[model samples]
Target: MSVDPKTRPPRASAVRKAVQVAPTAVGAFYATSMETFRCMFKRPFHAREFVQQAWFIAGVSIMPALLMAIPFCMMFVYQINILLAEIGAVDLSGAGAGVAIIREIGPVVTVLVVAGAGSTAICADLGSRTIREEIDAMKVLGIDPIQRLVVPRVLASTLIGMFLNGLVSAVGLVGGYIATVYMQGASPGQYVTAISILTKLPDFLVSEVKAAVFGLLAGLVACHLGLNAKGGPKGVGDAVNQTVVFSFLLLFLANSVITTLALH
Candidate 1:
């Protein structure tokens, strides 16, 4: 028997609602993101505050992540060296691995760390203030919450990400080199030669640019979610979790697109 149109599911209704809500959510998110970006540049650049935030994000928060990543990098290099040696591709080891790590993994991993540590902290702080009406209180006092709160955090994240990318790249290279050359018994000169041949100035530029973009995205996502957070403590926690998850996903997607385009 043919199905009657009257008894059919309201697929059109669900589609229409989704289409309607999509634009509204997109508009709201974009508006908030742009406002935060503008707020980041409006105030006087506070060197001391920037430095403090940088120290926390780039130094303190980076430590645990680096500690975990270094050993993993070392292990990866050792395994690669063994495999390459078996396949007579040992000459491809040095700069090839280094360049790959810097141009791709470095920024990606740095952003992941930032999302987990820095983004979570930012979201929680802002969300708490929002929930407690401190953000509203600022408006009542003629202080722009975006300018005072969002700006500093955004600036801090961007600067910190740039710095952390450099730090992680160097540490990863060193760890990989030591592991491959000494631990894995790959000749030191071979490793150095490989690195020297593989790495280029263009790779460094691309990596730095990726780091900057990742930093901006992470900060924007965290601040946007936090500022828009409603409800109470549960909302704050949800915002923090969402910020990290979204940032991580975006960072990986960006890395893939950038890498594909850059290499192509």
Candidate 2:
């Protein structure tokens, strides 16, 4: 029955343990996502939770979306106007603005705000609950957390994401117009006239699609990290941070892929 400490194997390092656990973590996340999706059609939909989450996400995200979209879109339009003026095509400034704002800037800004504000909020809320053992209590009471919690949050995020995208696109266009016409001396009438030249119905639709996908992914990331959090409060905080980072990475990758495929 005697055991020698010297003959025992050394414990695995943190780095080694993390590496070993990486694949399982990813698999768990995937399973969570599938289960969340499947539970979407389950009876007793959490309408109130969805509404509350949507309101929360919108409250956190809307102002940031407005404030961030203006400067970014305006500067981009200003630069485009300068180039177009140099080439004697200043009238086409609206086309450039429209293309940039709708096809990229609007969705991109929505991505940042949703991931930074909305998704982080979701993660923090759920993570706090997890740390408080509320999630486990729900499970003990035979409540399906995914149906009652994750589904509503995900749907709310997706709805808010699409709404924010539209709001950002409109604000971005106004900002771009101001930059082009007032700042760059572009003909206001011509600028307005050419907005629909390069951007049409399909571009608009694709942009909305991108926003929906980004929101869905961000929500999934937030919920997964929150539910799996450990180490008490520190774990919850870490999960929130990871939610933002992972949401951004996934959103950008989705954007690139969606844009490429849409264009082709």
Considering every candidate listed, which one attains the maximal lDDT? 2
What TM-score fits each model?
0.87, 0.93
lDDT of 2 by residue, 140-164 (tens): 9999999999999999999999999
- Residue pairs whose backbone atoms clash in candidate 2: none
Clashes (backbone N, CA, C under 3 Å), per candidate, total 3, 0
- Identify the leading candidate in terms of TM-score: 2
| lDDT tens digits by residue: candidate 1, 101-213 | 78876887788788889888889888999999999999999988777777777778888888778877888888888888778777788887788687898898889888888
lDDT, candidates in the order shown: 0.81, 0.94
The total of clashing pairs for model 1 equals 3
- What lDDT score is found at residue 112 in candidate 2? 98
